[model samples]
Target chain A: MSLIVFAGAAQFVGAGMFGMGVGGWEIVLTTFVLNFRHFLMTSSLSRRLPDNTTKSQSALAAFGVTDETFAVASMSRDEKLAPSYLYGLNFTAYTAWAAGTVAGVMAGSILGDTLKQSLTFGLYALFIGLLVPEMKRAKPAVTAALCSMAVSGALYFQPFFKMGSGWMIVSATVVGSFIAAVLHGDENE
Target chain B: MSKLNIIILMALVTYIPRMLPMVFLKNMRLAPWLNRFLRFIPYASLGALIFPGALFSVNPPAAAAGGIIVSAVMGLMGRSLIAVFASGVAAVYILLLII
Candidate 1:
């Protein structure tokens, strides 16, 4: 059980580490990029927080501003966001995530190694599931995703450029994003 | 580094971006281009994540192909994340069992 917890924590500690070899700096940078969306969430939610909210309180609240928690906090009916409410929201979401991870780890241990190996594909499938919704919504998403796929695939297989998975992923992300931003305009496609 | 160390590092990396804008950049306005670039980051990153790795992650080629196809179809159909992912994994697992 302790081993499972350690293994689970090692792998699922953050979305960025899922299904990848663990290199310290690579993990850190990949996580930073994965959670970069939080910048927008925090920016939006921070404004809703009470103007006089202390820096310490704001920082504390910011720590918990994940996608789910941010959505809940941002959707509150009250015009003014209370620090207490933000804290409660964050606490609930964090507890749920932690508990869920523990539950999964426990269940996984019971299932043993063969099934666990098969389940590794689940993470990749989940990534695909996440991307498809956005791709459906935006033309640029489709373009960028295809571009990323092509770039990453080429980097992985082509003998001339032997890029590591982490670096390849990051480079493809940058290129895809740059191309998407250039091609996508406010005007309807 | 140890698992605990990696987790802590993940926490720190995750925290910095979430903290910075709320702390110091609350009043600052980002350039329009930069905002648009950020807008597209998630999709692009997720894209970079899925390819080559996802397809090649599983064995036999058939299993990975089956899983990806099922997941892609479910996702395109607007299914929930869980449903889409489960279907994919299930497809792969079932395929493995048969072969």
Candidate 2:
């Protein structure tokens, strides 16, 4: 069960990170960044909660503010959300995510080495699936992606200054985001 | 790090963002520029994850390329997650069988 808790972030991007030889502090840090949107999600949902909600209850509700749960809770027709309703949404999502991971990992254990190696591409496929829609919608997004790909490729394949995959990923993220921010800076305009 | 350490760190790091705004920054507003930057994170991170690294995920390089092409096509076509994943793995699996 505790292992499954780590799996909360697994299905999304954790598998890819793990495949890249990422472990320990890097995994924790990457998970933090990946789930960073929860900050915005929780902030918005907080406004919908009843005025009398207690700190403890709010903290408890926040624990379940994943992307999926936030979407479900925010779409409720109620003008003011009760803690119980939010808890229900969170509980369902948490259970499904954790259960699925446990099932996936258990299944993976029995896979032959070659089968496991091929299946690793599933992680990259997941990442590409997440990317294409955004890139199609926005030119800036496409540019950012290309920027990241080029940087990551160079660092990954560089013979003289061969960089660790983890550092390569970190650098690519920074470079790509910087390009996108510069290109799309006046989004509010 | 140990599995225990990773588990603990993941929980702590993840919990902070989830809990902080709800309790302390409930009313704090993000700057528009910062929000815009945040929006790019997914694309940037995913892009980094796929290229170069993904290309080398499988041996015979050509098989990996084939898999990526399958993934890219399915992804651009707005296929289901399972479809995108299946096509990619299937392409690589087939390539490996042949070569």
Candidate 3:
């Protein structure tokens, strides 16, 4: 918890100046754009947690859910458990992420643009890693990937559909999911 | 407010969608439709991320060229993570200088 707080706060203190070219709205939009996955993950994990929670906490914790936290919370742990377990999982994950932000800042000075840029691929790699394992057991995952990639490629070159990069993802996800849910689905799919 | 403040503001706004559900919705059931919708997130999320980076430059072809090759090669070869990240970055960096 302290680490993530430090990292997030430290980022503001350090490179917050880089916001000139990128407006607050743009940054905010992109932030929503970039981490939109969390939203979907939350929707899924909600079912995994306790069946009751207040709107306020839902409003608050929804902001913190990440792919990792979602995975941790969603994992079948013996059986249905308390929401407190999810809270603890989230708190720990938040701390780790915020810590990374701070660590990223310190590392930023040393890491040049190329390396920094490459590091962004870590997310990409993580997705691939996760998908690879899932796909091995569930063919639906493979179908989803191919379908999404095709959609992505189609949208990438379209001129009039300049919906920006973020929305494109939302489109692809919806399309892909619908296809998977409807096309090649068993109960698990 | 300072530009830095704006970025921080953006970060906070971005953090909201991610953090809110954790604290609040941790123990709720998503509607069946929404649950179905959630399955596609990883695909969309990953696509959104990689796509933007590809379009980050005017010379999209050349800029993203190296890293794409590197990642593909590493994946097909089933190489280690370090090699995957390092080679991909190096390929793009080297390509950028030459292009």
Candidate 4:
């Protein structure tokens, strides 16, 4: 699944749903919604690629457009990102991801249940690590993040809101970012 | 459907969104409003991914909160990703041990 899907979040969500006996369509739909962010990442990245990059090379490079890779590539100081550079960046990340998965599987059996449960916190921590730097750069990102948390929290805990986790994230992100964009636009004007 | 079929479907769905934009929208310019919205997506998604769900991810939930605080502080300090992530995990583990 890791080799083929190559998406960490979607793989996690898919595995959880499968464990709980979710149907195929529901799983697919959830995965699609969760992965929709990649569209924005790839769109932004495409314009940065060198003009001489071939369609086939772009297609191959697109396969490796994970969040971590996109962040690294975007941060590069180069005026035009070479396809080779992207390939190397993506390949290294892909190797690390696959190797990490293997390592986790091997270590899972040796770990105690309590320790295993505690490790779940790492996922949230990773998110915070990804978010805080962005918040520092753009104050509006702080607003967006807070709004998302509020919306997501309400959707998850409120009895009136029956949406599943995938839809909840999608809804929260759209509303939160939309609000931030409006506020940001007003400030610019 | 079979597990194989499901896996194939997952791969398709995951790959299509990532591939289409790079392949087809390479030179297309985005509107300012849309660009603004896209800029906020990483933060918004990370925020949604962390909250409420993170609280319920571990026992007592305070452990998760502790990890979040540690990660946020370290991240703000311009710490490396591995350092922030490892410190957060270690904080959670230590908190759980104390609890």
Candidate 5:
């Protein structure tokens, strides 16, 4: 899954849904929605790549455009992004991700049930860890997050509106971000 | 769908967003409204992923809440991802042990 999906959040969400026995389409749809941010990152990074970069090279590098890699690439002081640099960066990050998954699996096998159950919260911790920084950085981020929490909470808990987790996430994200975009108007960053 | 089939489809969907913009939309600029919408997706999606579900993730909901609070506090303090994540797991473990 790590080698194929190559996305942390999507993999985590997919694993959780799979554990709960959700349908395959739900997993696929949720993965797509969760990973849609890659479009923005790759679109922004494309401008920095040297004009002479080949299509194959760009395609290969695109597979590695995780948030961490994008941040490192975007922070480079060089005017033109070098293909070699990108390849190296992507290679390293990809290797680490795959290797980390292997390590996690090995550790999981060794861990007891109680320890494993406790570790379930690690996934939520990851989301909160990633979101809280953004919430603190901008008021609009807070608005978007709060709105999403409200929508998803309702969708999950309300009998009338009860839906699959996949749909719940998709709807909440769309409505929350759309409201934030309309209300904040992109000025606050 | 079979697991292999699901994995293949996931690969395709994941690749689309990463590949299309860099390969085909290289020179194009998104409209301002669309860009703003995309910009907010991460926060919104992360939020949706965290709440309500997180509460039920573990046996005792309070253990999960403890993990969340530790994570959020460390995150707000701008701690490293590993620190926040490990501390959160630790908090849950401790809470579970107590309860």
Candidate 6:
């Protein structure tokens, strides 16, 4: 999953660089845009974990707190968010992500550059296929999505902000999510 | 600009935001209002990624028109997500192939 994120970043950066070359601003923007979700994930998970959990455990477990890991942890019915279990979930996910990335990068090293380029779209399609189901049944989820799109679109054209697209994306997501959560936090309760 | 430098810069910048909340948020509880905001993150993020690329495809207006139509019909008719997305994907590719 991280690798997919990386590939997406690579494409955006590579394409941007290809067209405009590297600007410090573009790099700054793309990085921010692509990474905002992790912060959201962390914020949510930190709230979900048991209050008694140790700081070290919380921090370590956070290493694994991703969308996939969050889904797993949140789904577990246990009321107390055990640091051990959270860390365990993080362990497995990080391991899986790292191992998969290594295997892919190593294997990709053997593939032609064009083939690798083509694989980029497959990642987006895979992401879409995976993400679409999550949005379909949940109205709040759909609302949240629309909010993000609106924010991103608005940001794209705004001249005053002068921020890179990446950071802009993050800002849009964070703010969009905040709006979604405010209106829809009721369902969880 | 070297690819390595650009990638490393992205790595550091991206890493800070992604990892910061976990390290710092351990002490911070979700405020009543903020909880509502978090629920929408995944949905919105996915929307942010998908809508642009799909709508801005080779034949933006046409493919988007088709995707929008198919998505609406499938969604309204209570078809499965797979069915809904399949219709949209088919619409996109078919439109692309034609144009």
Predicted structure with the largest lDDT when compared to the true one:
4
Contacts from the true interface found in each model, as a fraction, amount to 0.65, 0.65, 0.32, 0.77, 0.77, 0.41
Global fold similarity of model 5 (TM-score): 0.72
Off by over 4 Å in 3: A1-18, A21-37, A52-60, A67-89, A112-114, A187-189, B1-34, B47-99
Give lDDT per model, in order.
0.70, 0.72, 0.56, 0.82, 0.80, 0.60
Arranged by TM-score with the best first, the candidates are 4, 5, 1, 2, 3, 6
Put down candidate 6 lDDT per residue, A1-189, tens digits, no spaces.
243233344445656664786676676566556556677766666666676777666666665555456555643446557788877777777777678678887988797543443333333343355454556666776677788878887877677767655565566677767777777756764
Model 1 chain A is weakest, by summed lDDT over 10 consecutive residues, at A1-10
DockQ of each: 0.49, 0.47, 0.30, 0.65, 0.57, 0.34
Error of 4 at A25 (Å): 3.7
Candidate 6, CAPRI quality class derived from DockQ: acceptable
In order of appearance, the predictions have TM-scores of 0.66, 0.64, 0.63, 0.84, 0.72, 0.62
Candidate that beats the other on lDDT, 4 or 6, i.e. the better one: 4
Q: Which parts of model 6 have CA positions greater than 4 angstroms off?
A: A1-7, A10-37, A48-136, A157-163, A185-188, B1-9, B57-61, B64-88
True contacts kept of 1: 0.65
Q: List the candidate 1 regions with Cα displacement exceeding 4 Å.
A: A1-97, A112-114, A186-189, B1-14, B21-27
Per-candidate alpha-carbon RMSD to the true structure: 6.3, 6.6, 5.6, 3.1, 4.8, 5.9
Winner on DockQ between 5 and 6 is 5
Q: List the residue pairs that clash in candidate 2.
A: none
Best model number under TM-score = 4
TM-score of candidate 3 on Cα atoms, chains taken together: 0.63
TM-score of candidate 6's A chain against the true A chain: 0.61
Best by DockQ: 4
For model 3, chain A alone compared with the true chain A gives a TM-score of 0.69
Clashing pairs in 1: none
User: What is residue A121's positional error in candidate 6, in angstroms?
Assistant: 6.2
**CAPRI accuracy category, model 4:** medium
User: Per-residue lDDT tens digits of candidate 3, residues B1-99?
Assistant: 565565566556556656555555554456665565565555444544455444443243565556665665675566655666567666666666667
